[model samples]
Target: MAPSKGRGGRRRPARPHAHYARHGPQPGLSRLHRAPPPDDAERLHHVGPPVPHPTAHRDPADLCRGQLGAEWHPDFHPREDELVMRQHWSSSGFANTDLDFMLKQHHIRKILLIGMRANTCVDTTARFGQELGYHVTLIRDAIASFSWEEMTATFELNAPLYAHAILTTDEFVDIVNDGAGKGSP
Candidate 1:
């Protein structure tokens, strides 16, 4: 868990993404507010519900590149394009989306994860990797969150217990490029 930017008081509902960015970076979590780094070639996958109402104000092209550079919920009001593979986890990390199958098909023993809601999909997926016995690297800078307190709290306690959370996007990419291996925490 990293320190939060703490932008003033309570965050406005429309600016949930901003709220998360203000809270520094969560290693392995994908941030929606920032533009995708050009060099990312790890078959980058954005795991979240789908486009939300606020994203409708943005363009659809952004959705293809990770939903307005963010992740949206399936039932999010005023639906836009939904990420077909985003999965909903139940303890063991397997979702109807078949993310595990996709990884296996790709021969992806190492995963560079990024997406919305640090404590939800991001954390769940990391946990899922542990369950499936795969090496999961959480690129903190690449990830973001909407819940300030919960995000910080979870990383503070849970991350150390469950996953290897790298602090920057560069570190994340370098680790994968270096053939980083994942094992039991």
Candidate 2:
């Protein structure tokens, strides 16, 4: 939580809340608009083995080696040092997972989010990250929404307010390199 503005306009940290508020008491169709992702499901409507689109099958795992537990990229990139590129459904980001411990170990101060489905897991994780005090930047190119409209609308209504919607991978890499972005080791 951010602190109240002082008479001099100095900023301060807000006292931690005893508990975070739920978006709403119950999920409605609008809830689907912000639903969490399903990681264990054996299906991906667009990108996994089930997709009919040829290019869509380009293995996400191959492009995302860090999340797959592979060696870091040879580029010696700085974002590679701090930014975590993870599948929303993977055990990596779950509450009980080692992610929190890993972040602490690495002294991560902020998170720049990049992945699929802006409305589901992406949204949930961003919300969770904010509650935990990690600034999240949702890379627009890196993320693929379930639908054009959903993605467009989400970016329109939420991205500016909740997280930054960066337009390219290059910009994201630059931020991480500059240390403006940080996350788990």
Candidate 3:
């Protein structure tokens, strides 16, 4: 059966699991199974400066200030009036962050995700959001990755599995505008 149109009259596409199967496992999978090259092994073993445990000895505020400038304590790049949600973990914006509480406060059940490292950060966050019961949408064209493979893995392979909807930036804007009405600021 043909997919039904959404409230905005946009038809969602079929999941592309077959496309993922055509492509092999993501590059990271092979790297994980293989031994490191000799040069990398040497560098790995080399006694450089002792690495500090992430959260063992440092105050959270101090760590934030040290990692980011005092003026910009969080890693996010937000516009003047935009809300910023900071995340420490690679997966899940809600993990170790106030995102869940903030969303609940705002009564926001749906999320539109767009960011860098499509296969890594974006994919991880999308999956986690779906698992947490939020309706997750991905702005496909707005996101990017270091390579085509990575982008494909996230957008084609993982997003259909986790995200409730995938749309282009224009599509998203149109839906928002339609819902908000022409006079909305």
Candidate 4:
């Protein structure tokens, strides 16, 4: 685990119970929210930068904040064993999403992240989880980016810095089928 503030307000490396929670929306947050984002006092407090109506999807909540309801969710949702979270308030899922708390409650330490935005939101969430003492894994092909370069940069450079293992979808399936991943997620 990471360190925490000592008497002089200096953090020592690897503090046990005192491990600090380095999370939140970043500075200006609208721009710099990542890796223990700025404190509430230092972070942006505005509702938003003001976006236009949802032209792509019928549910504006999927694209904008302060709009919440079932309509914001996709058609695949409301299915069995599926979880529908509110609009992401920050780049790091653990920052405001209660994911870490939920994981720890279930005694889950390893995480497999698969989603869009390989470099931005996915990387931020992985790094934040790694810093908080979770074993993070990124599936290479399961994630995507706007460009090949972004995907390459994340899995090739940034992911190595934090992720415990970088596997492909096939490899993940093999692990599951081989009984190596039977009891966990």
Q: For residues 22-68, what per-residue lDDT tens digits would candidate 2 score against the true structure?
A: 12111121222122322211121111111111123456455344443
**Lowest summed lDDT over 10 consecutive residues: which window, candidate 1?**
74-83
In model 2, what is the error at residue 139, expressed in angstroms?
A: 1.0
Indicate the worst ten consecutive residues by lDDT in candidate 4. Answer: 32-41
Better lDDT candidate (2, 3): 3
Per-residue C-alpha lDDT of model 1 across residues 104-165, encoded as one tens digit per residue: 76565655555556676667767878678676665554556765554664455555576654
Candidate 2 TM-score over all chains jointly: 0.45
TM-scores for candidates 1 onward, in order: 0.50, 0.45, 0.55, 0.57
Error of 4 at 166 (Å): 0.6
Better of 1 and 3 by lDDT: 3
Off by over 4 Å in 1: 1-93, 174-185
Per-residue alpha-carbon lDDT of model 4 for 98-166, expressed as tens digits? Answer: 566656655667766655566777798889989999888775555555665676578656887998877
Candidate 4 RMSD to the real structure: 16.7
Candidate 2: where is the Cα deviation over 4 Å? 1-92, 164-167, 174-185
- Best-to-worst ranking by TM-score: 4, 3, 1, 2
- State the lDDT at 147 in candidate 3: 66
lDDT of each: 0.47, 0.41, 0.51, 0.50
* Number of the predicted model whose TM-score against the real structure is largest: 4
The 10-residue segment with the lowest total lDDT in model 2: 44-53
What clash pairs does model 2 have?
3-14, 39-89
